[model samples]
Target: MSGLSVLSGGFIAGLFAAVTAAWVAVGRTVGRRPRPTTAAVFLMAILLTIAAAADVVNAYFSYLPRLGDVVGAATEGGSDPHLKTADLRLSTTSATLRAHPRGAVLALPVPDRGSGFGATTALVYLPPQYFDRPQWKFPVLYLIHGSPGIPADWLRGGQAADAGARVAATGHPVIIVMPRMSHGWLDDPECVDGVGERVETHLLRDVIPTAESTLRVDSGWTNRGIAGMSAGGYCALNLGLRNRSVFGSIIDMSGLTRPTHAGGLGPLFGAGPQAQAAMIANSPDLYIGGLGPGPRPRIWLDVGRHDRTVAVAIYHMRDFLDANGYPVQLHVRSGVHTFTVWRPALREALSWFADDVARVSAA
Candidate 1:
């Protein structure tokens, strides 16, 4: 049932049938007087209809591909609070690569001492070439999910593992790792080191170091890239620009100009003069021009042509980066700020980023 597509004709038809049956049961209650049981049945039918409609909307957005994904998100957090390396080993056997050509997704606990945000697990996507080539060091691409999201969002909604595998087939394979961004559902840290949340330190200090030590990936900045969608996109841009020595490239898909939250920045930075300064430090637009002389990282700003609000806002950013002599690409495609647009973008970006990594490695 988990593999069943909610958009499939059979699945939609069954949902419609169930909803119709529920209404029919409610209709039968209408002529039986105003009994309490009749009212209860009518209420239940209304709830069923609403829930069915909600599921349809959810399917359209591709947020939850499988029924099991809902349960997985709720139980994604771990009990371990200590930062440690995952006990994993690389398999170079040809039989293992033949058995699973696309590669596999590993769920590992990535507790970090930097931020102590240890209640989550990171998802790693190892391409088939990882097992086929024993001595080759693959480029690492860190993919971040949107707000109110978990690491599995990239797998279930964005189809990130499938996208990475497709790029791998082109002989430019990359190790794509999705790490937990926020402390909780609806908690939007915007990947900044503000107040009590040191999200930036978590990714830079803990996640990257542990992955490099444990995995057979290139350790140089030129062999590393970062990409994200929505809130995660903002993070990719902010973190990549702020730490150019850490990431060689950045792919921002439908991101904002600065750190944002539905509740505003008050909760994130707190109330103080230092808080205001931190907010200024985190905003990419404010500091993009101040970046000193160095080899600037290549950046790709992707937004939907139909998404006018974000597309227009990021134009000045593209201009600023261009004016500063940084290599930047602005990609405008059809669709909005959802997975419908990001899924294909991730595939193309993985290929492009991996190719650049290969070129630099060859150089």
Candidate 2:
């Protein structure tokens, strides 16, 4: 069980104990009178029922998908208003700084070719200390956003840049890169070299090299980590596992282990068993098993307990990794398939990378 679950359980148990003690006190105060008044008994039963219902609701909220409001007032314009405009100011400490610190919108030139759609853009986040330490080459964490979202999703919804700035303020300087994947979905091209548009090539060949060359970043794999949310999570695991030489670690936050059989994947990539086989090969759980031991990248896999859709798949992937003797850090927490869960998950993942990447880079 995860820490959140354990804490919730303890809270519920304590509530029950408190209620029991109250009941005993009331019974003793009644002085064992012959048969308690019907009204008093009825009131006690109602209160107990209410308490039970509250506990159930609390548990459900803790694990199930958030359903109250689709868009909160805070995200009114699909952007976080809390992010200050001054935060967007670029510091002279780094030349790679992109996007206004206050807003999530960023406009970077896409690679000329092989980027699919003739337009390839990257979302860049520079830490607050990036300008303070001109001599330091900070590590990089490349985050891929999920479907129906562009490169700016991490900045807009996940508030990645702000989070990066906060971590940087703590003295753990790093850069966060969010790239726009073809079609905005993981199974779109299956992250293969030449499936439909060469997205894998664009990312591994073009994006990484361009970032290293243009930015003041550490070029070694030890200083690099990849991660994502939802479909992006799937991409992170697939790409990170395959290119372990480039990415030293991976953080998968609420990602599905396998593509759905809904036939969308087939039509999107092309046709035939060869294509299907290629797609399956890119799945981390499917291929990681074959790699067989040795120094695999540091992996962190997590999912919300209430996320019924992908939680089972994540569980299977975790089991597969453990059975294959692969090292993994697994976390099952209280949340569902929504930004509420992803926000916290992303924060924790970043902290994990901050600690691990620093050690690897120092070594």
Candidate 3:
């Protein structure tokens, strides 16, 4: 656990106890008629406790993949990924490094000259089949994580390893590529190219190419899917919808309709027409509204009913997708914006995407 996680847990424990104590304290004081102060204190305590607990939980364990898969270190990669080190750069002159079976995750340090965002290490998940059947190519899924998070977030609590194992057990395998999004947890690029960061270029030009070239994975849209959470969900929709020719399906979860940060859009994208243009270009709502005659890629949208921040926005997106030519599967789960909801939904999504991939292959 990070220091933040410990600090967060301590904070939440104090908060939870304080609120519960307050409610008890108030309840004891209240008589036949409820006092306004008592009522206010009770409501405040309940709401604050819920909000604080959710934040603490997400912060503490956001590093686990939904499935508990093992990760390994390699010597050829130069330094250790455990120490946030680099790997051998992919060179045409060098031999192709095959996926290993000892571990499901291979951390490779990838560079992005186009983005100018500095080099980032991606956590790539290889199924058992990847090693057993070296001759068979597999599908690819570009799974992204929430902003204010790192690439390791997907591995630690996303439950992807469990879902991948389930899929592989069915005689199907997919390469799951999780790239580090922000330079740091606080750096929100909105997954767009701008004055400082050309993040989209990093993913499309550098990350995708690196994964495809390094692994025996399919290179077509029919075999590819994109999904993310929160800000990452926004990127999945932005990248997947705009590049329908590249992604066959997308799972958007608890994503905002527009880009926002701890500061707000004004500071993140700069305040003006350029920001407006960026939002319009990146908004899936905008894309769905102007969708053309041809069928677009499959879209799945899910949000916890109790997702205070994005429940309404998700509903609006669901309506937009339905009313317009493009239709999405809207799943309103029974929880807030936590992995408690996402892990199960992710299982369904992988199954759904695999079905799509299977159908395309059969056709």
Clashing pairs counted in every model: 0, 6, 14
Error of 1 at 317 (Å): 1.0
2 versus 3: better TM-score goes to: 3
Over 193-231, each residue of candidate 1 has an lDDT whose tens digit, in order, gives: 877678888898778877776678887888899999888
Pairs in clash, predicted candidate 1: none
Give residue 88's error in model 1 in angstroms. 5.4
Tens digits of per-residue lDDT, candidate 2, 85-196, equal 2222333224544334332333344564555544566767766455555677879898887653456556555768667766765678678877767654223544455545
Backbone clash total for model 1 is 0
Better of 1 and 2 by lDDT: 1
- lDDT, residue 256, candidate 3: 78
Candidate 2 lDDT: 0.65
Candidate 1 stretches with Cα past 4 Å from truth are: 1-45, 62-67, 73-99
Q: Which is the leading candidate under TM-score? A: 1
Candidate 1 worst ten-residue window by lDDT:
76-85
